[model samples]
Target: MPIQNPLKKGSRDPYVTIAQQQLIALGYGLPRFGADGELGDETLFAYGTFLVSQGLRAPTDERPKSITPAGTAALDKAFAALAQGGSTANIIDERHNHPHSGRSVSMPYRPWPKITAVVLHQTATKIGEKPASWHGVPIHFGITRAGKIIQLYDLTEVCNHANGLNRPSVGIEIDGWYAGIEGRPETLWQPKNLSTPRQPMNFPTAQAEAAMTIVQWIVNAVAANGGRVTHIHPHRQSSKDRQSDPGSLIWQTVGLWAQNTLGLSDGGAAFTVGNGRTIPEAWDARYTGNRY
Candidate 1:
């Protein structure tokens, strides 16, 4: 059913739920409140953001009070494109411009063994959206704050991002500094000597959605190449020093959501690949350890 026009805040129409679901599917996260059929603040904010993303609205404009006809059409078009694998249109391939240093001198690019997982990370500082900003970065994908997905390396090449999981996993670097645990003071794991003071940043809905889309893209690409991506991990799971690599908010919004929605796994609560720490209990309640 098409979303009813003028679906403003406080509206509890079924169409409102439909819009919410579409927004969530596109990566405008309603973390606090889900698609509950109520056009509340969270949903409205997500809707406005979506409108802004599609150039239907301006950033300086106030959050849209009602879902206009144009917004509804734009939402439907985007959703249809996503269903038809149009999400790849959002990716900017910079692999040719910025290649990774291959794993060995003998072979410039080592073929990936069998990609089974994706490790997520945060830059711990702002990273620009241009290809020049990601030069020499080891990660396969880098998502900027504005939700641009930049491919820095080919999936077939074994680029070193995670310690032990490089060969079997792909890496996604979400651009921003986020706290390991939200609302907590940053002590260790805080980037040092920055020209400006570092503050905790929230994962924008678009960036989070880009991360989700890329994860699905990886799963599809790997399957096409005779491999299956079965797990989604945080960089912290592969390096003890990266206790806050991507942080809890991101894990809950993107990682845990992937496991629940996309049928992916996090290697269980106690599962840790290398000499790194476990996915902290704060990130996932299944892990009964306090090691964060």
Candidate 2:
């Protein structure tokens, strides 16, 4: 004999209403008709049996709570908002609705992953200055000279690079030439407030600041989605064995900001290398997949 649990009063939806009667008829204890919010324990038991009869196991308890009518309406509204590129986080002031780019770039793909880390790279070229395109060019999210962040590829997708592709990461390209440390003498450029390292050329403070803001945006976005800021990494750190883009200075700067400002532990990495390859130790959190 199943224990009776009655539905609350005045409920009426065809499926629920029918389900209620079915439970009552099936020798399950339940509320009498005309007083109800939804089917109770006995009804749910009967529903489970109904489903099992159809060759399916009962829906697991681990599933998200069943959608109520009100919840369903709210979800529809949320999807609408997301489609408009609305800002979903409450703490962040910035609301990006598709950043503007002067160069001809691809559309923003929306398969936004957990956004573990922000990998920064100097574009190594000016805006609209095309790089030689063979097949399998790496894609990037670009922040132009004017400080606009635009999507270079859809989310969770990969572009060609010297290293891994499509494993798990997003790349961002800032417009600038990456004059390696060896090229500093000819470029005659240096970073302000610090003795420039062995290589230096055209350290754009404005661009750096903008890049920080974007990183903050990404961090906030991840946090809002139940992730943490500790996962952020620059491109150089990811492929330390053979690559460098956002050079050491920018990496130190952004990483320190993440630690000091965001208060993240800086543990866990996001990049991994194998097949006789190696990713830098700093990027361990981003690639291996860390949970917030």
Candidate 3:
């Protein structure tokens, strides 16, 4: 049957359908016309309510804004390819585990034990950059801007965080760019070429949401593995003085989702600006006495 005129005006695409389904899964039960591609007012209202429940204000307008971090994350989850029915979902280092690698995450070089924590980074590199780096970066899985889950690593153990991927912790490098301190709240704009000065890389709302959903899955994985999940640190967090792949905005937004949606503890800290390290600053001897 053709999508009705009313629903067709702003019909929910496949990604939005996934979002609608996820919202229903989370008990929102937005009015979906049996997955027929028609999103009704009831569905919109339900989504708005879900937002409010997560401590975000309801969307003032009928049409929701996709650019917001929360909105983007939801869209991502809605479209994610779920884990094998009963099996756990994890992203392992494909470099070591790929059938072509001969050895796998199962034996010899597991990227674990030594892995102290999970590092989240964004591939600031352009979408067209060929031969994307798969070095010490442990990002095993990533959600695409279109809400697709791209598996770059397996959760077998770990491979290499440095030389040979680490075993225990996994890395997730999202395809996005920081909007920079001065240009945040604005979408990233692509640069013309290598010769052009570095500019903010913009990620679609659907993609940003996908990144957050991946974080939610990671938190669950950490709990199941018995690894004390401390910091969902961005690449910049590890090298404060030097690197900053995932700018502060992505970190904070994703961290909040981990804390709020999945109900994961933000490690017992109030709120730190950069990494969102949950361990209260007071507890850390390194903290000189900063409140936030």
Instruction: State TM-scores per candidate.
Output: 0.70, 0.42, 0.48
Worst 10 residues of 2 by lDDT: 89-98
Candidate 1 local distance difference test against the native: 0.76
Candidate 2 vs 3: which has more lDDT: 3
- For candidate 2, what is the lDDT? 0.42
Evaluated with TM-score, which candidate comes out highest?
1
- Model 3 error, position 23 (Å): 15
lDDT of 1 at 139: 81
Alpha carbon deviation, residue 216, candidate 2 (Å)? 1.1
Ranking by lDDT: 1, 3, 2
Judging by TM-score, tell me the better candidate of 1 and 3.
1
lDDT of 3 by residue, 144-231 (tens): 4454555655555454332222343566666656643313434343445757556664444555555665665665565666554555
C-alpha lDDT of all candidate models, in order: 0.76, 0.42, 0.46
Candidate 3's C-alpha lDDT?
Answer: 0.46
Mind giving the per-residue lDDT tens digits that candidate 2 earns over 1-292? 1123332323333334333323332333353421133544444545455444434455654322232443223322332222123333122111233232221224223244444545566755566322222112254456555545554444344444324322344556666655433223433233557564434444444454455566666666556656554554445544544344654334434444455445543333533443212233222223343321
* Model 1 per-residue lDDT tens digits across residues 110-208: 443467889998888777777688877888899998889898878877777888777778889988878897666473256568686667876666787
